[model samples]
Target: MPNVTIYTTMMCPYCFRAKKLLTQKGVKFDEIDVGTDPGLRREMTTRSNGGQTVPQIFIGKRHVGGCDELFALEARGELDAALQAA
Candidate 1:
């Protein structure tokens, strides 16, 4: 499995949903709480190419976007492959 990193805020439902999906898939992810840190938020924005939202997810080095995009990948049957990628 590849390294999964998710930038999340404490109270975001989308973030919780995204994490639940990943957990269901048996994927261990690095969760970064950016709720109180402006620097971390800035880092997330820079990494995501200006995505200023909760649950900015990355599988390995590839950006998988937010909760909706993550579910879209699952619906498309590409999420497993992405997770398994090197």
Candidate 2:
């Protein structure tokens, strides 16, 4: 399984939706609550290439952007392959 991580705020609806989608897809992830951790938030920003938004997602160290980007990947039939690849 890929090492998935998601940086999120407690009250972000997109964050919730992103997590829900990942769960529904049976994708296990490490969730970091950046709203409560400034250091992690800073790290997430760096990881996301300066995307200072909630729900910065990664799959095995590959920056995957946020909710809309995730959905876009799914729409393009790329998400599954990405998840399954080494």
Q: What is the C-alpha local distance difference test score of each model?
A: 0.97, 0.91
Tens digits of lDDT, candidate 2, 1-86: 78899999999999999999899999999999989878988999988889899889998978999999998999999999889978
lDDT of 1: 0.97
Worst 10-residue lDDT window, candidate 1: 77-86
Model 1 misplaced regions, further than 4 Å: none
Clashing pairs in 1: none
Error of 2 at 29 (Å): 0.4
Task: Give Cα distance to truth, residue 18, candidate 1, Å.
Answer: 0.3
Q: Which stretches of candidate 2 lie over 4 Å from their true place?
A: none
Q: Give lDDT tens digits, candidate 1, residues 12-71.
A: 999999999999999999999999999999999999999999899999999989999999
Best by TM-score: 1
Please state the error at residue 23 of candidate 2 in Å.
Answer: 0.4
TM-score of 1: 0.99
RMSD of each: 0.4, 0.8
The most accurate candidate by lDDT is 1
